[model samples]
Target: MSAVVLSVALSASASADMFKPSKAEQMKLGKQAAAEVRKKEKVLPDSDPRVQLVKRVGRRILSTFSEKEQPWEYSFDVIESKEVNAFALPGGPVFFYTGLLEKFKYEDELAAVMAHEITHVRREHWAYSQRDANKANVLLLGLSLFGGRRDVLSATDLLATFYSLKYSRQHENQADSMGFDMLVAANYNPDGMVLLFETLKQSSKGGKPPEFLSSHPDDGNRIRNAKTKIEKSPKEFPALTKINL
Candidate 1:
């Protein structure tokens, strides 16, 4: 009856494509995207306190990945921006915005954010999205060439579709569930994910919404979903603990 369960019932169809991008391909695409981001955003130094804390949380999360689930290489970066946003690229590139980092006083909350982003990579959402786009374009191109159909959806439509892709609600919920499991497995507080969602909801009240909330929506349902997941997780978590950065 939960929203997460309902979402899974509706959207958890197995993808039909069997030829997803390989790890090398994902790493190549990630490196390219990361370089473009680096050219525009100022990268924080290794010694910056916020950067250090993010890296620590990132590594801890990375350590919890199962062997077969390990990404090619994990590299976390702090971007110098005031907008509250963060994201992970296809392979292992993760970025955090300074505006977001300054708001967190504990590593658990930070871990929540990083774990969510990491789930996107581990789940191969980006590569699958790209694969879908490519298939559509190829089919459109073929129809134009062979079937003499030029009035099909335009390239602009394809671009719009790609950019406008909000990860399905099911994937978002799965990320929350997996991130909760990772927190419990690694001895971090699962409540941080819920706390992060609450903080995002609060910050969006008086002003513009944080950029993080744009792609990763934080409706109350997701918070409740995380709470349910924590309560039911099979991991034998010890007494929940909190740590200051």
Candidate 2:
């Protein structure tokens, strides 16, 4: 694949109760975290085929954004782990585990995963989550000091837990929606997203579920949602194709 400059503009959206960090701050923190991960985790070398494929798809998906919109210096790395998981840090450090990569049989499938992770960073979900968690902690502490009752504290904990789960589910769905658009915008087949979900569902049949699925939307719901989007916007997507590295 020809090299493309993949970048995204920093989001300036406002939040009612969240303390959003500056893009520079996020990048710095992400770099620190990524460095620590590299030090402790067994990262695959660039020469590894898996790493190369990840970078290739990642760059393609990122190319959908303009170069002038550069806000995060995104980097992709592969981890030598058996757990089927992938994640992106605050600014732009994305990691893929070998187990997750092994499940991907096509480049488009890989692109779907990469695009979803990229959306998380682009939307600043982690920063928002952290701020929300901080608020919950403060609220809980205030309740503890004022209420001084076990039942009151339990109720607050239950509410906080509910809100966290709801917010997380919302984020996961948003990532899926945005990532599907990015996949198509990058010229990969949009069906790749739905197929990727199907693969995950199949993988979870008779054994422990993938770590990737732990925080994500239910597989059935995700697949149905993707299909609904494609059905709603048939003209927006190109003909389906199987893209292999």
Using lDDT, give the best candidate's number.
2
Model 1 TM-score is 0.77
What is the C-alpha lDDT profile of model 2 across 106-202, one tens digit per residue?
A: 6778888899889888998876775565445544443221242322322233324422333388788888899988987898877888878888878
Clashes of each: 0, 0
lDDT of 1 at 215: 55
At residue 180, candidate 2 shows an lDDT of: 84
- Total clashes for model 2: 0
Check candidate 2 and list the clashing pairs: none
Per-candidate TM equals: 0.77, 0.77
**Residue 12 CA error for candidate 2 (Å)?**
19
Candidate 1 per-residue C-alpha lDDT over 1-245 given as tens digits, one digit per residue, 9 for 90 to 100: 45654443334224444325666767766776677677768999999877888888888887877788855777899999887778787788889998888777567778888888888888887767665654455444422222523224333443345334567666676777777777766688777777788888887776666534665556678888888887887765454344444
Once model 1 is optimally superposed onto the true structure by TM-score, how far is the C-alpha of residue 78 displaced, in angstroms?
Answer: 0.2
lDDT, each prediction: 0.70, 0.71
lDDT of 2 at 87: 82
